[model samples]
Target: MAGQIPIIPFGPHATCTLELCPIEYSIFRYRPSLAANITFVVLNVIFALTHLVLGLRLKNWWFSGAMVAGCVSNIIGYAARVFLWQNPFSFIGFLLQIIFVGSAPVYYTAAIYVTMTRTVENLDVSLSRIKPKLYYVIFIVCDTGALVLQAIGGAVSTVSSGANAAGVNLALSGLIFQVATMLAFVGLLIDYLIRYFRDRPVASVATRLKLFLASLSLAILLILARCAYRVAELSEGYNGVLFHDELLFIGLEGVLIALAVVALGIGHPGLVFKDGQANLTKAYSPVSVPGGAESGVELVGK
Candidate 1:
């Protein structure tokens, strides 16, 4: 390709003309085998199809939407890499996947927020201190903040070849915001889980609830790992040591996130929400009150 780096794909790459660009240079860093890349592509595509069907079949819009967002980003990003494998100089393909896939985690995070809050509402909102609406407002705002920051970072780096300090700063800031949001979410989740499990009604799907909580935790862990990788990668600027490491990005961001998505799917609220077993009114009795009504408000205090 004219005006582009002459980079090789992964292993035993054929020699080319121009020098590799910093961004394209790492297209195969710590790189997986061609076989692994193929696996990643296939797995993500299958996940996307499954979510598309489930979202439509059950009308679980939020979970379905988030899964779709994640799968789409992963697929598009990998597709771009596939094109670059043909010719690593294709900057356009590089950007399309990098930006979309990098930010896709945010949507999954949002989906988790929706599901968890919905669980609270559908199960026992009165036991919780924070209302479901406020939880939505707060977490979604954080998600939007992360999205905008990452998007700006992508735009800025594109114009400046990923070395723009401003762009790196913005991206890092967004990631930091996401990390903080997740930490808070985890705290609330732990608190809620403790209270819920301790006082759970006989009707609650205990096993399913455990799975949902586990999946949500896995998602948070994946996002946290990705953010840490970004922070390390960007701290050194575009050409810095970790900046162009494709292998690291794939392992830390790609595989970690893909695992989280699958985990979340297994623990989806649909597992718990199905069959109306969670209906609260008929399951609880005022007479079973812990404090003989002297505690004033009915609380599932742990």
Candidate 2:
């Protein structure tokens, strides 16, 4: 026992430094990539700045705020990863990444939810089953719930140093809830589009609207995919195979979300909505009744 190296416990309370403990003892079981994380940080900063400028210029407050917040969360999360690259056993770094990175996409989803209302209102509000405003209200509320779950789970995991099953389960529930919410949102969007095009042929669809819809759809799908991946990764808890797969994390979590952020920028409502307010008069003008009375009703009233 005199010549043997002393084994150190790995956790927040662990006195193990990188010099003392093996990297395998770290929560991730591997060192986080410095270059990859730094790249994510840079990408998020650029997109965040872009959204900030555009949001300010067009006064798209909600969209801008959500995007900026999401990007900032990403920045902080990846920065934490950078710290982990230096010290894989760092409790603070692990906690930051778990909490911030895990919940960042909720903000992106929140932005999309708000944008959907405007998109439906601009295209044809009557085609949607629910009021355009309800899209944000319902989905944003769900997103908030998911965020709260994930945040609490992350906190518990940190406190337990990644050994708590309940904490992992709570986070997994959040991801699953988020994925389900996104699926429902996509279903409603597709339903609206189907009804819109069926009633008023696709040839009449504006090019701008088409691009916005395409970008929006792409963003939704990407984020949904990422959320699904996260759910799978968290399913096995901290020591799961997918959880330790750096390549999977990079592709699924990092690349997928980065592309989604880009898609959101391309499909920003300010550029498509033309001043960001629905032309209610145009969308729902007065209709002439048989008795010669002008009734204020939507053209395609539900």
Candidate 3:
């Protein structure tokens, strides 16, 4: 009974053929087709190549690495999903992806956190008020906690099946926590950006900064939306609602994650031509020098 896909809860509430209720929970091991496996691999390949190029172009290994990690994890996770598509009971595949893909963004978020603060350091450090390092330190701490909870939750979810209420709860908690964390991070970033822009309103974004910020924001938004959807879908226990709905999972999870990877590519700071000499000379200073001193740097509040 568990191996087969079960009737959906919201449907007739009567006997339902698997066809009648596509959203029914299925205990059978989830499996993927050949096309799916290929898709995942392709995604990862593109991710690797894009990040490598970006790293070279921007000379920002940390940013490149974080983006690459997210993309690579996504690729691996999708591959695992494809495996599950082949064998629904492939717990190993599910676990590998659930752990890696779900938590990979922590690295990206940390990169964003670090990048923002570093931007301030490079710019008018005094205008930033808080030390750039502080954001990295604080957010990294929170991101680590989120990663732990999500990993634990994913593990619990895989084992629980329809009966693992506790695990489901844990997974839900982690998803919710992650969603909250991302939102907070986004808010913090927006705040900083607002301040930075206010102080340096006239300074156009350097090409690298534009790509870096764009890609980072898109990835964050995509992940945040995906997490929110997952939380909603999984809020009901496997047997109760659209617990094991595959289509929704593909749409919300697979597509969203894929988009994140692609967005990262487009937003890769690599598009800008890197001048090695300038980087060596400027080291870590802000790219532009806007209105040098004399006038007070004003704080622009939202």
Instruction: Please give, for residues 136-228, the per-residue lDDT of candidate 3 as tens digits.
Output: 887778778767876776666566654667777877887787788778778876776677666554444444555556777887798789888
Which stretches in model 3 have alpha-carbon errors above 4 Å? 1-25, 28-37, 56-58, 127-129, 199-208, 240-243, 269-302
After TM-score superposition, what is the CA distance of residue 41 in candidate 1 from its true location, in Å? 1.9
TM-score of each: 0.78, 0.89, 0.73
Question: What is candidate 1's TM-score against the reference?
Answer: 0.78
- Give per-residue CA lDDT, model 1, range 97-174, as digits (tens): 668777778778888888877778765687676987667789989878887897888678655656578987887788
The most accurate candidate by TM-score is 2
- State in Å the error of residue 61, model 2: 1.4
User: With candidate 1 superimposed using the best TM-score fit, by how many Å does residue 144's alpha carbon deviate from the native?
Assistant: 1.3
What lDDT does model 3 reach? 0.63
**By lDDT, is 1 or 2 better?**
2
lDDT of 2: 0.83
Angstrom error of the Cα, residue 104, model 3: value is: 2.6
Question: Over the stretch 40-74, how does candidate 2's per-residue lDDT look in tens digits?
Answer: 99999999999999998877888989999999999
- For model 3 the TM-score comes to 0.73
List ranges where model 1 is wrong by over 4 Å: 1-33, 200-205, 275-302
Regarding TM-score, does 1 or 3 come out ahead? 1
Cα shift from native, residue 20, model 2 (Å): 0.7
